[model samples]
Target: MFLNNLFSKIFRNQNRIEYTTGKAVPLEEIYLSELEKYPIWIYALEEEDVEGQDEFWVKPITNSTNVEAELSTPYILLKIKENNCPVSALLDIENMKLDDLQYWDYKYGNWEELNKLDMPSPIHLISIPSILGKPAVEFSVDIKPKNQTTAIARTLMGPDECKDMYKTLPPNICPVCHTPLKREINPNFIVSNKRSCLRYTYDSFCIVTEDFKNFCTLNHYPNLEFKEFPKSPGNYYFTPLNIFPLDPIRQKIKFEECCSSCGGFKGAYGSSPGFKSKNFTLPSNDFIYRSDIEFGSEEKKSPLIMVGLETEIKMKKFGLKGIYFDDIYE
Candidate 1:
């Protein structure tokens, strides 16, 4: 974060060029009539994969998510051409809310649709680091972790392991994207390995902490069932008995190729930042829950793992690992 500033080369009646001078520059130093700089995170800016590189690319990071930037600094400003004019918006972390993003695609630019108003631009989303507040009431004031890291670990039920769950895609699958027009989980998931103790998984597969499970039990976290997986005590797996439909959008998530099934998608893409969707809906803040909407890929998919803010605060005392709560955009 304490690095050298960045500067952009200015060209008149031509395109604006940006470059770094081995130092970070103030947001004001790179002012332009045609462009505006926004704050974003430095965590993985250089490594992030924005699907439509041929059509659009990320704007220069004039304002990285250093300690001095916005409270939610983990973000990136994406630049795309709309009506032959440069336009951009912030792709925030965690909360995947693309409030003002436009004309997003997973493949090459679709110039014909640039002028279409209210067309939601697909972009990356992540949760920013946040400070926990006082709990409404403690879930278990007595329970605490010896060390956060050792207590929790991430888990993924990859392709081979999850294949039998859906041996074949439903017949009504989208012919273009190959997404099942109507699909559902196998419902029978056995938690095989239980030795992990506390698992905290994220991304398309929303695995949560088993420690938080214990903590939430006292406070009445519903639909949470921890059984023998890997044999010792607790693990993460999708259980239909515990799922409910809370993910807001009714449309299918896509990476590219405008299919009748998906909103906009082409190939394997990262999770959409649905925080900015006009029809965004969130699970109630009353309980730590799971979304009926499944995330991840056809090879391997998982549920939209979710936790309520209030419940998150209550879990704080347990000193849980690998868990953070981003405000759900309603």
Candidate 2:
């Protein structure tokens, strides 16, 4: 009878939805309001807390560098600093309704009435070490609804692709030096251990064939000399030539090289238009980091801000990476 009771208790616990308060809510027929009662718990990295410790909270996964949480229905993954570090509890959106959630709407393309809301004022500016070891500025924005307490944290500047200061330029002109760029010709070469009979240099890597040589001679520049392959094999192997522009400005060339077969370089690299200028204007200070709260009261809060110190560390990725606040859509 004791053994039977132990098995039954285990089964019951497995089926229960545990909250941070040591309370269990049935997994089925659970309402949004029930989950909101628990404070959004923030666990230290690798800290093992009891299930349901906070119904809507975040914690680091076991033996992993990522912090994960299910904010209502949306699953969030954050890349933060070192392991075992304390996580700050920044926001709580329990009383928020689905229609009033802007974070969810923006991500899922259900954007409606987004611009009608007032932008949240910046509460704090935290400088944290990004995955790239550069100091990344995080802005904490206060949420509204006078009665509900919620906030959001995001990077001061959004993704690099979304930045407004960077611009692209047209082709032919060297992206680095703004000078006329020319193609480089070679007799033979090996790239990635593969042999090529001929090569043409531009921003894009390309190889030319014998047919391409004939086509270029007849139709294109007929005066240009084309090298002929010897009928008898020789012990000659070609060294890769540095045809790339030496000028720092010329290195950013956006023009792609073309071959005779397809009239363009195959498997081309760095084909995207290079930046027009090398200098980048920093983000404006007037910019506000918006929050997810859409239809809440416009009540204002005192600017009680907090900022974290920057730490330098090695990372696995190249660009800046961090966790941003997101809302549950479902």
* Candidate 2 whole-model C-alpha lDDT, 0 to 1: 0.23
In order, what lDDT does every prediction score? Answer: 0.33, 0.23
Best by TM-score: 1
Residue-wise C-alpha lDDT for candidate 2, range 273-295, written one tens digit per residue? 22112242213221222211111
lDDT minimum window of 10 residues, candidate 1: 134-143
Candidate 1, residues 1-330, lDDT tens digits: the string is 011112111111221123221222222122222132333422223322432111111234343322222222222233342223332233232343333332222232211122233334432222122212211111101112222222111111221121243345534455656544443433443332322223322222223346645666678766765433343244444342454343344233453445455653334333333232344343454455544455544433445455555555454445443233333333
Which regions of candidate 1 are displaced past 4 Å?
Answer: 1-210, 238-272, 276-284
Model 1 — TM-score against the truth?
0.34
Clashing pairs in 2: 18-52, 19-52, 19-53, 20-52, 20-53, 20-54, 176-249, 176-250, 177-249
Off by over 4 Å in 2: 1-35, 44-330
| TM of each candidate vs. truth | 0.34, 0.15
Model 1 sits at a Cα RMSD from the real structure of: 18.7
TM-score quality measure for candidate 2: 0.15
